[model samples]
Target: MSFHFEYPRTIAARRPGEFKPAAPKFHVRWQAPVTTIVSDYIAVQRQASDMAAERAFFQRMRRAFDSAYGPDSFEEMRQTDEAGMVNSIVVAYWTDIVRYALWKHVDSFNAWFRSTEREQEAVGYWRETLTVPYDRMETIFSEPYYHAGLARTRQAALEPMYTAGYFGAMRDRLPISAIDPLNSPYGETTPEGNYAGGPVRRVRVDVPPNVVSIRSGQVWQKAEGEQLDDYYQNLQPKLETGMAYLKEHPETTGYLSLRAIVHLDKDGQELRETSKHGYFLALAQLERWAAEHKSHLDIFKHALAMRRKYGADRQVVTWHEVFVLGTTPSLEYINCHPGTGLLRFANVWGNPPPSN
Candidate 1:
């Protein structure tokens, strides 16, 4: 039987509302008793000025991403960044850091990254990687049929979850928060023109500890007719607007950076899926935005309506994997545009929130 209301949680978990959820919810079950999983967000990007060259540059690097020592599973995604530059991203996953490290050693990736070739006239490249322990992460889904992110890691199952659609729900889902607040020592304060939007090559932002990141995705390749129409016509617009708001107003929203990507297959086939990769200073701030922000609420309202409309026939699938980073931080920007990835927040580590 599904343990929807009886899932394990600590004191951090929130009490449910008088009304049950509008629909069933689920979470990823690890293949075995594991402690950590490696999540790597690697991007090969370029400004309009270097578009053709960057695409050629990125194609040459594909072999490295698909190496024998590469991640257990991964996804190829594309996006046009806020700056109007285009980015091709590889969302790679490894059950452990050792294998990923091996891949790095075996592949020409590190060599190319450190080479002088990346120092050309135009900019393009960045990575935001995290090694999350089991206790520091939470995985939830709207349906048992579709899965992504860590679910591709040979998961045991997608079991029913108890707490969701409520403020503080993600915190309770993470076992560490039961005792520790998982607060970041820093805030999302980017001094305008200091470097955030300026020209900079080879930048590295030391991401603060306990910083939170989430990969929320939507898959609708299976939808047909009305369900498909609803997702694109109504639900998608809400999501786009919300993500744009977060990307543009990170300082106020506590979002360090947001990347909205369209999924693609290895063969360059575009898939009917999208993902939002958002980095925040703390989980509390993320919760605050989700619970109170108009942008997010709009998305929530439309999604709920779609769920109600389709009922069991709902072909749209949504899921997310949220985690708080530990002390070991690994983020880098190489010959990248000033606004690429977390490059905007480059070199701002452990500083108190910039004076209001």
Candidate 2:
């Protein structure tokens, strides 16, 4: 790997001769290592036919989350998955897992989640959370700009990345990958959903080994005038198109599930911010898609163009957190439309590259 300067790290362990990335990039450095970080994605959804009810449920939950975690930052987003369901999501992050535990038990929030009324409503509810140790997560940044996503540390720093922007780079960036091949399991990949048109069927998913999940965030809130127009008119639309492809062709791309989300306000209304949280069977599959897919390549080119134009003054921030989850990632959906997120490959999905 090649770097123009040196900086502290908030990335995974590095490897040997065959391990070091020949093409170097940049990443972030947190204040200190977080032993465990918990990310919770709370989603409230309903069918396209029940738009009014769904928005109501979304606002109610948003109010509940705001009251439960007053000072902490909770990012809100909207998702339309492949199930023909409209979902409103609130993403909460806890650097210390213990704090998350306290928040989870908040009386009002818990009551809402456990209430019998939820079974009666047309709206569906789901939360897909994953708690991972420090070593399992890998992060990278193109420039020393914004600390988007989980990199929102108290005072984050930026460092050079030796292993990124190329094929097999994610595996090289992961410290655990040095020892564990981080491959996916091969087994029965059938789903287990009670799709009998019930309003209260809750299914808990068992995450297969080495399943790679990523939260790629892009915030154009700081852009203005021409930059703003470019982002909304060209950049963001491109991102949405790519996300749709990933959602539609999961088997071809090794993407089990994907969500293109827009930010929400206190009133649960959508804003300019956006992000994509995706899941793949293995790190290698994700890398292949990023490095080989034309869809991703277009996104990559547009990013470079914007970065070059603005240089350090760029208001647009792009970042992503890549985590190879340990088994038992918490993925649950209640009354959700069928085939919602990781549900498609319920019985231990494996990481086999799509047929060429």
Best by lDDT: 1
- Summarize candidate 2's per-residue lDDT along 201-287 as a digit string, tens digits: 665667777778898888777789998899889888788778777766655566777777877776666766777888877776666
Give a tens-digit lDDT track for model 1, residues 204-286.
Answer: 67776887888999999998998888888977988888877776776666777788888987565679999988788788777
Give the whole-model CA lDDT for all candidates, comma-separated. 0.75, 0.68
Which regions of candidate 1 deviate over 4 angstroms? 1-11, 17-23, 47-62, 65-68, 121-123, 187-193, 196-200, 350-356
Please state the error at residue 13 of candidate 2 in Å: 9.3
Candidate 2: segments with Cα more than 4 A from true spot: 1-28, 47-72, 106-108, 143-145, 153-163, 187-200, 232-234, 346-356
How high is each candidate's TM-score?
A: 0.86, 0.78
